[model samples]
Target: MANHKSALKRARQSEEKRMRNRTVKTRIKNVVKEVRSAVAEGAKDTAAQDLNKAKSIIAKAAKKGVIHRKTASRKISRLAKHVNTLTA
Candidate 1:
């Protein structure tokens, strides 16, 4: 328990932030999964489209500090590479 009043307020704020962050992270994962499944199903065009959407969501999440920038970049790069190999 947070003993001080300020500490209690901080704890409350932290919990709210954690819940919000979790939702954003969950959305990011779902989008990424959509892209991955599209790729796995051998639908390059669909995968590409989904990747674009997922990338944007990831970038937004990263910008908001919900996820690391490098992680977002890496995910986009990897998905792009997979789609490339399929089309190539």
Candidate 2:
């Protein structure tokens, strides 16, 4: 229960941000899963494509403050490694 008007506005903003962040996080997870599944299926081309898409999504999430920059970099690195391994 927000007593002040400003507090109520803040609460609303927080809830909106939370929902947006949740969606972004879910999207990130789904993209990562897609990349992993492609790799597991031995589809190097598909995996690489998915990795690129994932990298972009992760970077945007980091830029938007949904996730940490280092975390995004780590995710991109790992996905790239998997794609590379598939190619190699």
Candidate 3:
């Protein structure tokens, strides 16, 4: 238990932030998975659409501090490559 009042308040704030961050993180993962699955199934149109969606979600997550900017960029790059391979 936090002894100081400020510490307790901070703990509450941290909990709120954690839940928000977790939701963003989960959304990003789900979008990425959707892209991957579409690519794996050789659905070029669906994969492209999903990849764009995942890229947007990842960029948003990075902006929100839920994920690192470099991490998001790398993921976008890799997914784009995979989707491109399916098209080409």
> Scored by Cα lDDT, where does model 2 land?
0.95
Local distance difference test scores for all models: 0.90, 0.95, 0.92
TM-score of each: 0.94, 0.95, 0.96
Residue-by-residue lDDT tens digits, candidate 2, 1-88? 9999999999999999999999999999999999999999999889988988999999999999999999999999988988899867
lDDT of candidate 3 over 1-88, digit per residue (tens): 8989999999999999999999999998899899999988999999989988998999999998889999999999999998999967
Candidate closest to the true structure, highest lDDT: 2
Candidate 3: clashing pairs of residues = none
TM-score, cand. 2: 0.95
Cα displacement (angstroms), candidate 1, residue 10, comes to: 0.5
Rank ordering of all candidates by TM-score, starting from the highest: 3, 2, 1
On a 0 to 100 scale, what is the lDDT of residue 81 in model 1?
Answer: 88
